[model samples]
Each structure stands twice: as C-alpha cells, then as structure tokens.
Target: MDKHSIEKEFTALIQQYRNVIWKVCYIYAKDRENLNDLYQEAIINLWKGFPKFRKESKPSTWIYRIALNSCITFFRRFSRHPQTLRLTESWDFAYEENVFSSQIQELYALIHCLGNIERALILLWLEEKSYAEIAIITGLSQTNVATKLCRIKEKLKKMSNQ
Candidate 1:
C-alpha cells in the first residue's frame, strides 16, 4: 500500500481497537496519567507492528498480543525508572452504562486492590477469551491461565468480603 493508504488503514484499525488499548492501560496503570502514558505506548507498539500483521490470527487476537506486550514492557521500564511514577487518583469512566455486567465498576475497584500487573492479565482472561486464546496472547499455557484465574478469583472474593 502507498503511504497515504497505509496511514488511512492504520487510522481505521486504531479507531476500531482503541477501546481495547484504553481498557488494558486502565487495568495496568493505577491512575489516569499513567493510563494515558500506557495507552500511548500501546498505540506506538501497534503502529510499529502494523506492517508485519500477517493475518495468521484474528485481528482482535493480534491487537491483544500487541497491547499486552506493550503493557509488560512499560511496566518493566517503569520499574527501572522509578522517577516516572505519578499520582494514583481515580478518574471517571466516560460511559455511564455497564459494559461487563452491573458489577463491573465494583469489580474494577476490586481489581485495583490487587495492585499488580498480573491482575490485568487475569481481567483480560476473564473478559471471556478462551483459555487457549488467553494463553496465546499471554505466552502462557491454557492450564496456566486457568490456574492464575482461580487464584485471582479467590483473591478478589477475599478482598470483596473485607
């Protein structure tokens, strides 16, 4: 494709998958400022990988792989550069309607309580991806995803009761 065509295609793809990027960033980052940084990182990674998209997998799957990888890399870098840490204040969700059932907001708050990147992985797995798909995206086995999810659920339940 020509430069203009490539840019147009990239823009369309970004618009289509923007929600996935934002949601993943929100899950990984503690607050809005970090969320924005993570979101930008994810987008940059997506753009870099666009040319290599072979269509060997579903577009959503490909997008998820890029997003999760970006989050992982961001966390690693952030860990090394602690000076980049920012305030962790909550932001209002743009949509008022429930997206993942009525308890989503509470669930999200509970997720924040977990306070780790692993929670982001578990949340993505629980987003109804098949175990195999989760494994593929996360570079883990189906059994591993299942195991982690079980532990995460127990943690959330325990947190909820507190």
Candidate 2:
C-alpha cells in the first residue's frame, strides 16, 4: 500500500483499538501522568510496527501484543530510572473517577500490586481474550497461560481477602 493508505489504515486501527490501548496502559500506569506517557509510548511503538505487521494474527491480537509489550517495557524503563518528577496537585481523583465502581477501583489497586507479567496476564483475561489468543499475544503456551491465570486469580483472591 501507499504511504497515505498506510497512515489512513493505521489511524483507523488506532481509533478502533483506542480502548484496548488505554486499558493496557492503565493496568501499568502508576498515576495519570504515567498513564498518558505509557499510552504515547504504545502508540509510537504501534506506528513503528504497523508497516511490518504480518497478517498472521488478528488485529486485536496484534494490538494486545504491541500495547502490552510497550507498557511492560515502559514500566521496566521507568522503574530503573525512578527519578520522575511529581506534580504537587494529584490526579488520583480523576483516575478513580474513570473507573466504573469502587469494586473495580479496589480490583485495580490489587492488580497494580501484581508483577508486570501477572498484570498483563490478568488484563488479557479481563478483556475476555481466549486462552489461545492470550497465548499468542503473550508468547506463552496455552497450558502455561491457563496455569498462570489460575495462579494469578488465587493470588488476587488472597490479596483481596487481606
């Protein structure tokens, strides 16, 4: 395809999958500012890879892979740096307000405590992606995905009870 076509398709794809991107980013974001930064990083990576994306996988599957990988990498990079400047005014209220309910907010808080891979796995599960699709995006075997998800659920259950 031509440059214009590629850009058009990419723009459409991003628009269509915007929620997926935000959900993935929100899972890894420490706060509002970090969420925006993670989103931008994911968009940049998606644009970079769009031109070369093979059609072997479904669009959503490809998006999940790219967005999840981008957020995970962003988290690792920022964790290593650990020198981000914070604003005096807080964005926590806005973040909480975006969530549908208190239970979801609490669930998110528990999810935040999970390790990066666990968070990613749970995010995919919450999105109702099939085990096969999760395996594809995560590069894990189907059996591995099932086992990890079971462990993650138990871990979350334990955390919630406490």
Candidate 3:
C-alpha cells in the first residue's frame, strides 16, 4: 500500500480498535501519563507491524497482540528507570454504584499479582476473546488459555472478596 492508503487504512483501524488499546494500557499502567505513553508506544508498534498483518485473524486480535506486547516492553523499560520509580496504589471501592468500575479496577490489581506476561494473557481473556483466538494471538494452545483463564478467575474472585 502507498503512504496515503496506508495512512487511511491505519486511521480506520485505529478508530476501530482504539478502545482495545486503551483498555490494555489501562489494565497495565496505573496513571494517566503512563497510560498515554503506553498508548503511543502501542500505536507506534501497531503502525510498524501493520504491513506484516496477514489477515488470518481478526483485526482486533492483531491489534491486541501488538498492544499487549508494547505494554510488556514498556514495563520492562520503565522498570529500569530508577528515578521514575513510584509506589503502586490499590483501587478504592468507596462508591457502591460503581460496582463495574470497582470490579474492573480490582481485576486489574488481581492481574498484576500474576507472573509478568500472564497478566496480559488474563486481560485478553477477560476481553471475551475465544480460546482459539487467544491461542493464535499468544501462540499458546486453546487448552492452555482455558486453564489459565480458570485460574485467573478464581484468583480475581479470591482477591475481590478480601
């Protein structure tokens, strides 16, 4: 594709999948600044990887892979910046009506308790991705995805009740 066509297609794709990117970033990053930084990095990675997209999977699946990978890379780089260290804060559930919001925040916290990349895997699963799709995106088996998701749910429930 020429530059203009590529840009157009990229814009369309971004419009379609922006929420997926945002949710992935929000799940991993604590604050707005880090969320924006992670979002930009994911966008850059998505643009770079666009040409390699073979259309074998849904576009959302492709974008999710890129977004999650970018978040992992960002975490690694951010961890190395000693001066940038900040204490992680737990989500508050003071507003009872915001149960969904509180659940999501609590879910993010629970995911963080998992092993490094496992957190990303569970986030993708909670996004309601099918096991086959997740396996295709993460290069894991459907059975593996199912098993991990089961474990993740139990962990989240246990944490939320605490």
Candidate 4:
C-alpha cells in the first residue's frame, strides 16, 4: 500500500482496537507519564508490524501480540532505567475520580503484583479469551498457557488472602 493508504488503514485498525490496546496499556503502565510513553511504544510497534500481518490470525490476536510484547519489553527497560523521570505536574485527582467501577480498580491494583507474564495471562483470561487464542497471542503452547494460568490463579488466590 502507498503511504496515505497505509496511514488510513492503520488509523482505522487502531480506532477499532483502541480499547483492547488501552486496557493492556493501563494494566502495565506505572503512572500517567509512563502510560503515555507505553501507549506510543505500542502504537509504533503495531504500525511497524502492520504490513507483515498475515490473515492467518485474527486482527485482535495479532494486535495483542504486538501490544503485549511492547509492554513486556518496555516494562523491563523502564524497571532497569533508574533515571526515568516521573511527571512533575501537580497531583490530579481526576484519574482517581474516573468512572471505572471499584471492583475493576481493585483488580488492577492486585494485578500489579504478579510477574509480567502472569499479568498478561490473567488479563487475557479476564477478557474471556480462549486458551487457544491466548496461546496464539502470547506465543505459548495451549498446554503451557493452561498450566501457567492455573499457577497464576493459585498465586492470585494467595495474594488476595494476604
């Protein structure tokens, strides 16, 4: 595709999948500024992978793979980089007052404690994706996905009880 056509297609795909993208971003980002940076990283990776996309998988599955890989890589890098600055702006309660239900907010908080791969698996499970789909998106075998998810649930059960 030509440049303009590619841009249009990419824009349309992003618009269609924005919510899925944002959920992964919000789950992985540490703060507002980090979220913004991760969002851009995910989008850039998605755009780069667009041309090579084959119709062998669902678009959502393809997008999830790109988004999750970006999050995992960036999370590792950001954790290693001590000099990454937090936002200096005054505290905003706006996000605190946002419309997500308390249960979801609490879940997000709990999700932060798991290892990165665990978080991804639980996120996919919470989204109601099938094991086959999760395996494809995460590049794991279906059996491995099932086993890891079982372990993650046990971990979460312990975490919630503490």
Top model number, lDDT: 2
Q: Could you arrange the candidates by TM-score from highest to lowest? A: 2, 4, 3, 1
What C-alpha lDDT values do all the predictions have?
0.73, 0.85, 0.76, 0.81
lDDT of candidate 3 over 46-160, digit per residue (tens):
9999999988888998998899889888878777532221124554322222345555555566665665567777877777877898898788888988888887778767765
Q: Where is the poorest 10-residue window by lDDT in model 3?
A: 80-89
- Rank list by lDDT: 2, 4, 3, 1
Q: Model 1 residue 73 lDDT?
A: 84
Q: How many residue pairs clash in each candidate?
A: 0, 0, 0, 0
- The reply for model 1, stretches above 4 Å from the true place, is 80-103, 115-117
Model 1, C-alpha of 41: deviation from truth (Å)? 0.7
Q: Residue by residue across 1-162, what tens digits does model 1's lDDT show?
A: 899998999899889878877777767775657777888999999989999999898888888888878877887877653322212323454322335543666676667556444665676766788888888887888888889888888887887776
- Residue 162 C-alpha lDDT in model 4: 62
Which residue pairs collide, candidate 1? none
Off by over 4 Å in 2: 81-99
lDDT of 2 by residue, 1-162 (tens): 899999999999999999899889888888888888988999999999998898898999999999999988987776964332122323373443464566677787778778889999999999999999999999999999999999999999998886
TM-scores of all candidate predictions against the true structure? 0.81, 0.90, 0.81, 0.87
Candidate 4 per-residue C-alpha lDDT over 21-92 given as tens digits, one digit per residue, 9 for 90 to 100: 888887777778877788899999999999899869999999888999999999787686433212232222
Clashing pairs in 3: none
User: What is the Cα-based lDDT of residue 6 in candidate 1?
Assistant: 89
Worst 10 residues of 4 by lDDT: 85-94
